[model samples]
Target: MSLSARLEHHLQASGLPFEILTHRYAATALENALMAHVPGDHLAKSVLIHKEDGPMLAVLPANHQLDLSRLQSMIHHPIGLAPESELEDLFDDCSPGAAPPVGAAYDLDTIVDNSLSGLDKVWFEAGDHRTLIEMKGRDFDKLMQDAEHGSICVH
Candidate 1:
């Protein structure tokens, strides 16, 4: 298991130390959290939503789900989930179906769910599904400080 080269470079350049945790093969973020033995609330799950302006990455806890209506209202635009085929091209450096929450690494707009702010720790896919990148919550916050923050996830 490995991180996408692009994401690895982004994390390295950010100067924030992190660790990679390997887990059993899982199909969903919740499964990943379970197999990885991490708190579901602290697992960062990324969803790619697209609109006329382009794609935006919506990040939330694995225990939560994206509230598409809320996001559409916030952005004031019609939006929908990006297709898997499109994601393969956009996140080319990563494995199919696995997306890192760090959208800046892929040059996409990003919005993080407020529920994930100010936690003790956070974990997300390593772009290879079987591995996770773990880091301090403050460090994760610093990386996403510039991204919009909102209640985009339903508890």
Candidate 2:
């Protein structure tokens, strides 16, 4: 089985019910809308930010942008986008455009949007452009226990 298949298998084995969506390479926001078949606001976007010490994963709504200041205060650090060159070395499973919320692959901490707590389910990349995973937001939060919940939105 391929890496993508393995990922899906792992999620299944973990008892996380999810739906996989395939697309012809759309932007993260666009991809989420396409997958949910709804407005962009209905989708959650996971943004991977790297700090001086390590990486921090930030999950936000597709319709909103990340508020770095709020994130910094919450995580207690100045976070920024991982350098293009550093991304591949640190996150081997991360493709050019697909950065999943799973931080185990990179040994980084994760922070999810507080708004996600209200949603029954959410969508995120499945390590590739052609695949997206949709699962219960609460289940995802439980799975990612180490992830901190905060305001990742730009307001």
Candidate 3:
């Protein structure tokens, strides 16, 4: 599969300039960075989490680890990682391990790590293992306008 139809629609409808980047297939964010020759810190990784309300997406740098405690405190409730099965059910249009960081495309709330704010550009999986979507970091923030921002991770 290529980029998810919903993601394409969201990006196009948002009118934020973006580019589709093709690279060797990769199963993890770090592998995607290596294959695409981009800095790990510039690659946004999507981690799915569940809260009492519903599912949420945590977008962070590929080189960083999600700090569960920090995220929980910021959200003021317990949250835990969503399993691969849940990911499959939620992102059926995409391959395993390859969901775009733009959670709004899937009607889910997103949380962006403040660490990503310093990045000049951002790259993330485009719903498949062999492609990424690239855009200016400011544009990314625009795409994530509804997302909450906090120090949700540590490198």
Give the per-residue lDDT of model 3 (tens digit) for 5-74: 8899999999999999999888899899999999999999999998889899999999999999999999
- Model 1, span 21-121: residue lDDT tens: 99888888889999999999999988999889888899999999899999999989999999988788888887787889999999989999998899999
lDDT tens digits, residue span 1-155, model 2: 11354455557667867777666666566665675474555466667788888777777777788888888887777778877666556546556656666664445677878776656777777777666777776777666666678877863
Would you estimate the TM-scores of all the predictions? 0.97, 0.81, 0.97
- CA RMSD, predictions in order: 0.9, 2.8, 0.9
* Backbone clashes counted, model 3: 0
All candidates' lDDT scores?
Answer: 0.91, 0.67, 0.92
Which of candidates 1 and 3 is the stronger one according to lDDT?
3
Q: Model 1: which ten-residue window has the lowest total lDDT?
A: 89-98
TM-score of 2: 0.81
